[model samples]
Target: MYRAGIDLGGTNIKAGIVDEQQHIIAEASVPTNVERPYQDIIRDMAELVKTLLKQKGIGETQLKSIGIGSPGTIDAVHGVVLYSNNFGWENVPLTEQLRQYFSCPIAVSNDANCAALGEVKAGAARHAKNAILLTLGTGVGGGIILDGKVFEGAHAGGAELGHTSLICGGEPCTCGRKGCVEAYVSATALIRDAKRAAQQYPESSLNAMCEGDLSHMNGKIPFDAAQDGDTAAEKVVNDYICYLGETITNFVNIFRPDIVLLSGGICNQGKKLTEPLETYIQDKCFGGSKAFIPKVACAVLGNKAGIIGAANLISGKER
Candidate 1:
């Protein structure tokens, strides 16, 4: 049987059709235009699904279910988006509205969880039964997969790895918390560090990369400067790795998953990022490499992870 996966984002709504093997057979997307009413967005989502089915010549009777990966605090059991700062949404009955257009079972969960699930099913952690996925983007979002299933905990609000405290009272976080892992390990955090480093070392190449405008610096500036052997950029990159190492080690001690998958633009650093991260995690993890060491690697699926993972949620079937 086929299933439909919808990835709802502030900028776009992406949908895909997946077969039993978890391969996307067909897909489509549209601009979200979130300024419009929520109902208009939902209607567009329904229309997107119908358009895909029609393009593939597949009947609704042939599909098994529909799954959605949304941002913010999702009430998965009720298919409601409790809140989404990205869309300025709260208490939206997303699934109930979609039901008016289709009759199949529908499941909804946080987009981060969906991305993790996708990695477990068909990406970097495809071979592992228990794994964790960290997406180091504007924020450090993550999800945990235990025994080949997404672990949402009570209220479907667990596994919010980014929000966990990294420092007792460090930088403020968008979540209204102090010193969250996201405050240090995310791309935003990296940019913040780079800007500070530029101020401290006026001779550094990072200043030129950002045209001396700290506001223009991004996550890549520091890494690029570090590659040129700039001491200031090196320090920024090292400090970022240190916090990430601490967070990964925490997960290793707690979950002991078979593998840890890293995603997002940060992963583009490739070995420059993963090599040192692996070394740091190896030294800091609870048990040494002698006993059940978990491999840390970059996620292979990229953007497709959310859609594919959402589809997997409907059946809870692992490849």
Candidate 2:
């Protein structure tokens, strides 16, 4: 009747108790605390699970399973965190370690895949058989749902859509790739572009907002300025829209998915982000008629999608 979901993020460990209908019944949190030793971080997760379960009046026997959406590369079948940049984890069997405390079946997947699965099961992609869920946060993350299933490539690392080349040798990405979408259209890029805009237009208000703190700049700087009709802001967000549009247009040309869900805090810029992206997508996708484009919209579940989706990983599996 219930399942446990954990979104193990860089900043926080979010655990939720989800009903069979995919609604969150109760939730708990713990800091990921990457600076802490490895065992302590694992203890954080294990302790949170017990805390939520005990307070929610749910016993281990009532839980169908547990699902974890973890950062970095993972071996889901073996429950290993192969290598993760966030927690400095290497070949750590998280599920096996956590199960030592919970004694319940556990499913694990990359965070992006879990987000995509979450969208497919209960969020934006619910009605579609094939879709892509793209979350534009500090960086870009992607998940592919094909015929009602997460399409894991041979190594369970399929759909690195963000790293897909948009321009050859354009911008260097942390992933060691040049011209990846994240390099051009992520919140990182947005902030970088904002700073450049502020330099060129010293009179702009953006300079005052962040007080010149580059890290304080985010995807919203340009978006907020654009709302006020500032030409400098328009330039940054427009360029962002064009490159971002180009990225998804490529997906349409390849997969022709029925839906493409927009997500992340940056995406909430609303029509300012979506409208231009839709226009650019229509112009670039080669296969479709001029009149039609893939349905593109925001992800419905917000942050909870990850927690709810993590619970759905064992859709056809048992406790």
Candidate 3:
């Protein structure tokens, strides 16, 4: 049997057909029409799926299930997006809508959780029965996979690890909370902090690179600056890593997962960011137990972990 995994983003709606081995047999993607309203976007996604079917010579009857990796607070069990600031959705029954097109079971989870499951099933955390995947993007996103399954929690809203508080009454967070890990470690936060620092250290290469418009910075600002040993950018990145390390240390202390896979554009810098994080985690983790060190690694799947993980859910024998 074949399974389908769909990743819906504001920029792109990506999907792929997977076989039992979790290999991509066929795939489809299209730019999301965020300005065209919500229904139109859904239709566009559905059309993409149909396009995949026509190319792959598969019918709805050949598929076992479909899973959608959504971008916001989702009621996975009920297939409803409780809210999505990204997609402009509020309590929309996404899975139900898709079910009308395909009779197979449909499942949905936040993109981060999907990434976690993806890592556990087929990526960097493939050897781990319990692990977490952190997605560092414009904002930070995370998912926890325990016992080889995603523990979505009572409200299915748990494991917002990035949003978990680290600094109280500190920087403002998009969630209206103060000093969330996302607030401290996200790309936005990194650039914001770097800009503030650049104002004082105006001669730094980072300041020069952005032509003093630090607000327009990207991940490359800190990454490139650090590569060339810019003091301001190095300090900014170091501070960000410290915040991330402390937050993750708490997770290691509480859950003792076997692995924590870092997945994001910033993680692309690899050891430049991870070495410091590992050192800090080793120094600050709650347990003196040397045996409790979770293998911190970068995500192997890049962007496909979610699509592959979602497909894995429906890969076995059909019901």
C-alpha TM-scores of all predictions: 0.97, 0.92, 0.93
CA lDDT, every model vs. true structure: 0.88, 0.81, 0.80
lDDT of 1 by residue, 1-319 (tens): 8989999988999999988888999999999998889999999999999999999999999989998999988888888999999899999999999999999998888898899888888888889989988889998888888888887767757789999989958999989989999999989888988998899889999999999788899888888999999999999999998999899998888999999889988888888888888898888887687756688899989878999989888665332
Give the winner by TM-score: 1 or 3. 1
C-alpha positional error of residue 296 in candidate 2 after TM-score superposition, expressed in Å:
1.0
| Candidate 2 lDDT over residue span 1-319, tens digit each | 7988899998999999999788888998877888887778878887888888899888889988888998888787787888988788889888888877876789888788788878877888888878888878888888777777666565755677888898879889879979898898777877888989988888777776678665677777777877788888888887888888888888888888888888988867776667777777877789547534787888878878888878877772221
Local distance difference test, candidate 3:
0.80
Off by over 4 Å in 1: 317-319
Q: Which ranges of candidate 3 are over 4 A from the true structure?
A: 313-319
TM-score of 3: 0.93
Q: Count the backbone clashes (under 3 Å) in each candidate.
A: 0, 0, 0
lDDT (Cα) of model 1: 0.88
Supply candidate 3's per-residue lDDT for 95. 82
lDDT of 3 by residue, 187-221 (tens): 78877888887887878888888877766777778
